[model samples]
Target chain A: MIPNTKTDPVIDVRDLKKVYHIGEIEVPALRGVNIQVQRGEVVAIMGPSGSGKSTLMNMIGCLDSPSDGVYILDGLQVSDLRDDELAEVRNKKIGFVFQKYNLLPRVSALENVELPMHYSDENSHMQQRATDALKAVGLEDRMRHKPNELSGGQQQRVAIARAIVNEPAIILADEPTGNLDSQAGKEIIDLLLGLNRERGTTLIIVTHDPDVSAAAQRVIHLRDGLIVGEGESR
Target chain B: MKLLQVLREAIRSINSNRTRSFLTILGIIIGVAAVIALMAAGQGAQASITGQIQSIGTNLIYVMPGNQLTTATNRRPLTLADSRALANKLRAPHIRNVAPVITDNNDVSYGKESLQTTVYGVEPGFEIVQNLSLSDGAFFTRAEIDSRASVVVLGPALADHIIGKHEGIIGMVVRINDYPFRVIGVTTSKGGSQFNNPDTFAYIPLTSMQARVKQDLSSGRVNYILLQAEDEESVKLAIDEAALVLRENHRLNLRQPDDFSITNQEDFLSIASSITGVLTIFLAGIAGISLLVGGIGIMNIMLVSVTERTSEIGLRKALGARKLDIMLQFLSESAMLSLIGGILGILIGWGLASLIGFVAAQSGTDLIPVVGWDAILLATLFSTAVGLFFGWYPASRAANLQPVEALRYE
Candidate 1:
């Protein structure tokens, strides 16, 4: 469906549903979920274990498709898009920061950051863009260092650098500081907050930590497969 | 993804695990090397035989005494009269000189030095019909043949063996089976000569050999005939006329198979080449098994690699790599492994073939193995195909991985 004359929200969902089939068993991971967010809003998704928060994030990130209903990402109906097209959407619009950092262990930090940029349309200025992104995350000196060579915080910073290098519309962090100490976690949260405020990048974080949720301007709580509560965080 | 980028990634992955990559491609290297070496040997043998056939003479046909499969009752010994009849213009118009040869093994002695060698009693025209040329002095004349003179022409090797010197060999007298014969000339050596070893025979007049060397056979009989046609173009005509004359002389009817066999270099060439061709293909087939095994090894290792790097694959997909991208990455890795192996195999095969050829030459075998560019190209293409064929399943498996599931994998 086309967005009308009204400015469309960056992410729009309606009646989203997901079902997992493990052999003969049917596990309904999500059912009848609806959500929409503006272009520059920072939203945190919070829920206990088995609450479908991960599945919802997976749908929102375009990593997995909704089993039924519609997901409109940047005004395009992503639920109807094929796998390759969805991959393109993910590459162009979303940047993910995983809990484990997930930097390729053998590659240098700069090369790790250049991974997302390789998929980006602007191929000519990849080196410069990756350098700028890494510099922004204070990893310029660690550019040539590999993941195993770097500390946990520096590896996460490289991950962040990789996420923002392509200048995606939305940044999705799933437990971005889950493996870090409090100081490193605080640093990562502050860097993400800085990106949100300065660049007006839409941010959605899935986390169990209240400290992570408190930083978000708005928080959406999920239970089973539905969003049961919403509030502004202090 | 860019092709260059994909290739670089493949190279990097291969480089990261050098030992495993080397071990994986060892089968390919050995397979390709074996194919190249064996094919080269087959081609070398074919070429060597063809050269020997050419050295026999231009436009020459050999008339052997008996059929290859004929029994003694049907077998008839070729006679000098038959050779003489073929030389007659009325009987065989295209025929040139005919040399009827009668051969015997004899001990040749020069003073105290003695050697066992074949002695051929051939007519004066043997030099022309058998492609022998005088390196010193002269061949025995027809007058010598008529008189059954004791003049003998030594083969180059025989001259060297008897006199132990090349310069004083022309006038030296050597005893052939205790009969003294003056060395009138020495024939030039033709290496790897098949039908008659030109370098090892002592040639005397045919009448002398019939009377003294082989007293058992009748005066008119000889072992085989060498018939030289006017030119290469007239060879078929010459052979047909010779056959007709011989068949009439033998009193063979139309239904009867001829007692004698007449063959040319072309007949020998085709038969020899076909055998070598078949041998080459068989050897290459055996070598190809190793490449197939090598390919399977690559596929196995690739599968392990995909499983080990599941999270990396998931991360790449999440970062926006398509299925084709992932598939290409793995496919190229396997291809790169095999391509490198193929190249290395070519070098190894060439070196080993040359070494074998050199060793054969040292032992006077005269084999020269050739590793042609065609073999190299075929091996390259075959190895790449092997990589693609065996690499397909693992590549597809990696490509079809669901990002969420792969990401969650430990």
Candidate 2:
């Protein structure tokens, strides 16, 4: 694990902008957003609907390139990377946990965790590593169970295990507890926070819940594709 | 991603919707099966017809009255005198023998049984020129032909229908067109085709037929002349010699064309083969149309699959799958479906061909459908190409999807 230091931030963004063209109309999804986060910091991004938080998460996840920006993820400039190269960056350096716990429906929990490794270049001991990751999420006994076969909390745990299985530098979780009950959501939040504390893994959570935002070390509120406020959480 | 992994994913996805996948590939199956079975039938028909033609002596030629290719007004009937001229050993040295035939249909009866059958009036040379063999007694002699005796040699099938048996019926007298004639022999059975069957005819002296049946012995004209060459190598020489003798007998000058046409066994074989070849191609072309429809079916199914798996594509993309990976995944799925269909179609088509052969054999036709390895290879290659070609558009659409928009799709 890399030690947390103020000298170098794991994620750096300056004046990032994204505009989507819908026929003849230019729709601005992101407008001059700047953000920087240290290694291992748990940051929560809160916003209402139509605020472009999803677009921001897409940019950070390297799923889409920004229209204009100077963005660096883990010391590599990714704002100008092509689609395939961005995919490689996402495969090696970033992991994603969707709101619906987007584990492949038909595959087993262990196989779901192994998905990221399939895209990565690490071809050795993949099954063993997947099994170990499932054990870390406290669902080793349900490793062979599919996503639908597990409970909401268990499915989210499997999704977390999948995100961290590749040992990524940053875990981008979009409303990871949005589909679960309060108790299951708290269990998911605890599991994600535990992962950050134990592995020095960076966490970026996009959410509308105050409880989720309050649990983070820092919260950044977004409005109309720009950061409205930033503060340290209690 | 590993190729094996991609294929495994494709198989898994196909298995998830087994019924739809099978239905989608049904078009391919029917198309391939039709192609194989129809081609087999065509080849079988050609083989059967050609085999029958070859069974007739290869060195034989036919001289028919009038130019068969032209619509000329002036026509002359071929006479026994022209046949005799062609038969002269000195002038037509290549011709081994010549038979002048006078044919007429008559009702023959033996006791209570009666049937309308063709009566072929031919000279004694016909037995040798036509390669006829007797199953019972002997053919009518040259003396009987000269004396115009009422001795008849029945074909095997004709004797069976009238006398109910070939043995001991040689001395029986059958009434031909109400005139009594003694049956001397019955020729051996020669498997017949739809066009020509010699087994249903009766043979007698040409003089007897002209005097009794026709009642017009003035012209002494014959229907056709069958000429046998000394060997296969002399067939062309024999045709030329017979034509020259016939033209001389008919008094045609150098500037005028002869009023007759000549054809050999090779011409018959080639004509039969060409007809069957065209039939085979026509059948295969129709089957190919069905295969094209099947390809369209695959495209339709693939498009539906791409739309249904939109979120799955988004999930894979989010998990860092490249555009090529998604494209290959769908492409392999469609390819796998068509490959399986092609193999199944081949098995069914082979069984169908064998069944056709079996049915044909049961009905006394010696036709065996041939399913060549080349046909199977062609079908396999074509089906795979169809899968790939039809799979291209849907796969590209899936690959072009934006991950965020796809994930947001309900």
Candidate 3:
């Protein structure tokens, strides 16, 4: 993997803003928010409620477009791309983990992991890749179990297995430990750190827990849809 | 994504809600079944009427008084003289036999048994012209007809009603409208058909009926004339000649419509077919309305499914599924639902039509329920179209969902 520094961040954003229209009123969710994360870097985004962290996560994950921004994902200009083109970029470049471990409730865990590969053109070895990803998440034995059949932590593990199945450039997680107990939360954070160190994957995590943020190599704070502070973590 | 994968996903989703899916497609099942059953019944009726016409001999024609489309009231009725005139070889050489038919509804009795039956006063050649055969004694001869003899030919059913046995009934005497006549013949049984059950009637010579029974003999009027054409090819010639001879006999002018109508075997067949065709269209029209309602039901249920699975849609989108993929998934689900329902409906309709045919057969009517492959194919096409048409809106709704908005939905 190529080592990327601040000058060569995998994700680059500048003056990104998102305004939602509710009839005549415009609610600005993200106001000129900008961030950059290097390859193999574990960064955490922390913010109070309604601070537009979720909005920022959505923009970075390519799930929504900004009203105005210059966003580049791994050197490709993505902020102006169409919905289908953005989906392609997300499929190949970004993986997402939601707070609720949003795995499809009806399918088996292995199939859940294989979900991302279905959208990929290089899907010939999807089954083998999904099995390997599940094994990496320590869910090899629970491959056939559905999401509802697994524990909350196990389900989140399955979600992580899905996120990494395509070997995406960056993992964007939203409150990954919010629904877990202290023990499961610690295990999840350790897993995320291990992925960053061993695979050189870029991690941009949005979290509320200070302990989770303290484990990251860097922390960026947001308030009122703007970045307020940034510092290297111990 | 591959089409097979989308279909697989759709099948999995539909299988997850088996009961609701089945209930949702019930309207389609019933609608398709109605269409099949109505079309089958109409085809069966047409076949049955055609068979009846063929059984009556394809070469026969009926010259009845008055227009077939209008009232016969006040029109000059047909007469035995007109029938005899049409039988002349030089005038209507295509005619094989011309039998004058005088019909009266009467009560005929034996010792203590009596029956309300019809009495047919026809010439001696009626048995041949009507394609009837005797089971017991011979039909009246021309001499018997000239003598105005009180001899009668009994239909099998009428003889059974009067005498209780077919073996010794020919010589038995039965009363017709309180007048006594000796039964000389008993007709062979024509199976229990829906139209024209001649087995309930007794036939006598036209002279015997006119002289002994009718009070209007001076009018020289007979109800109608039954003409047996030489062959099916000669029917047109026979009809034209009979019309000409009758018009001359009745002294009608060229500008006026004839007082009588000539109906042939083919005419009856065509009329019967057209009526059933119209009926089939009408029944299918009604069934089409129900199918439209069924389509609406599918749309409503699919919309509900889209809303209920909003988060799932969002999740799929997040996983990089395109709008086309999402749309195809829902479309396949709806199409599969309607197609399964259509197959079940075809079976139900076949069974119902067979039941109708069974009942009709038991009553001695030839109704063969026809389920043509064309009907099945049309039904399949129609049901699939319904699925696609009804599937579009909800599928588009699911496909157009914004991942952010959908993920936030409760």
lDDT values, one for every candidate = 0.88, 0.89, 0.88
Of the candidates numbered 1 and 3, which has the greater lDDT value? 3
Q: What is candidate 1's lDDT per residue for A1-234, written digit by digit as tens?
A: 122335778889899999999999999999889889888788999999999999999999999988898999887889978888988998989999999999988889998998986766677777788899999999898899999999998899999999998888899999999999999999999999998887878899999999999999889999999999999997
- Models ranked on TM-score: 3, 1, 2
Clashing pairs in 3: none
Candidate 1: stretches off by over 4 Å: A1-6, B64-96, B102-121, B133-138, B150-204, B208-223, B230-261
| Docking quality level of the chain pair in candidate 1 | medium
Tell me the tens digit of each residue's lDDT in model 3 across B1-410: 88888888888988999999899889999888888888888888878778877887899899998886765445787877888799899999999998889988888789999888789998888888888999899999999988989999888887777789777786788888778899898889887653557888889888878877775656678988899999989999999999999888878787667889998988888888898889888988898888889899999999999999999889889989889888998999999889888888888988988998999889877789888887788788898789999999999999999999999898
Q: Which CAPRI level is candidate 3?
A: medium
Highest-DockQ candidate? 1
* Model 3, C-alpha of A99: deviation from truth (Å): 1.8
| Residue B197 in candidate 2, Cα distance off native in Å | 3.9
Better of 1 and 2 by DockQ: 1
lDDT of 1 at A152: 93
Please give the distance, in angstroms, between residue B162's alpha carbon in candidate 1 and its true position after superposition: 11
